[model samples]
Target: MSSSELVRVGIQIICEHLIEVLKEELKRSRKNYREDVDVGGLDPLEDPESYRNHLRMSENQFEELYEKVKSKIEKQNTIMREALPSRLKLQITLRYLATGDTYGTLEALYRVPRCSIGRFVPEVCKAIWEVLEEYIKVSRTNLLNNIYLVHSLT
Candidate 1:
């Protein structure tokens, strides 16, 4: 495949992997919230030790987390459409690929399937890099003024 196409596929693989990690992270965070936040029962001050709360959120914190998650997700979607971009999935995927996050740990940040990530990343890598080589090599050598570099060196 062409380098750009390959790169796009590669990018997609990374994005897919990142999506998987994100999905997992999101799931894990929900679980933590379920366990720790303890929606509606008794205050910790009131009851120190039982399976106390059942509510997923307190009115305030719930509102806050909800907004943050919603905002982040929306931002991600918005970034996808933009021409100049953050490359959201790639960033997160890089984090995982670079950081070696456990699936469970990754589950907290991304609500994605690890299997899907594992399965497709190779394809994405292949697609993107192959195309990428051509894309990068197909350079337009328009000579810009070298005065900026010349001055800086002097």
Candidate 2:
């Protein structure tokens, strides 16, 4: 081969090796930051009032909702990383709904990437709605009745 051809081949091999190394470094760094952060330290579930204020629901309510939707929203762990827990997924979704916080804010607070939060929020919300659609319709009817009764009394 010509010397120019040999040099080009050597550069291509080096570029391929560098890309592999960078991929490994990226994977290692990702594992270090997100999944390693101790979300349990926040422990919002430990305080019933705080949990209600933050998530707009009591712990019992959260648990009931979680139980109903867990099968749909729960993810399996994989070789690359552990899946976010079903309870955490529900909590995050509820917090988002309660606060209307941006995904960037949630990522900072929750130690989950905004991209993952964006992806999971819709999935969890769908699961919750699927599980609770009938309950919500009934609650709406009851609420309308209560409003009418109050107006009648006044």
- In lDDT terms, which candidate is top? 2
Q: Write the per-residue lDDT of candidate 2 for residues 69-113, one digit (tens) a residue.
A: 999998997656678887877777787777777777877778777
lDDT of 1 by residue, 45-114 (tens): 5543321222233445433433433322322323123211122233333334445565445445554445
Model 2, runs deviating above 4 Å: 1-35, 40-45, 138-154
| lDDT of candidate model 2 versus the reference | 0.74
RMSD of each: 23.2, 8.4
For each candidate, what is the lDDT?
A: 0.41, 0.74
Error of 2 at 66 (Å): 0.6
Candidate with the greatest TM-score versus the true structure:
2
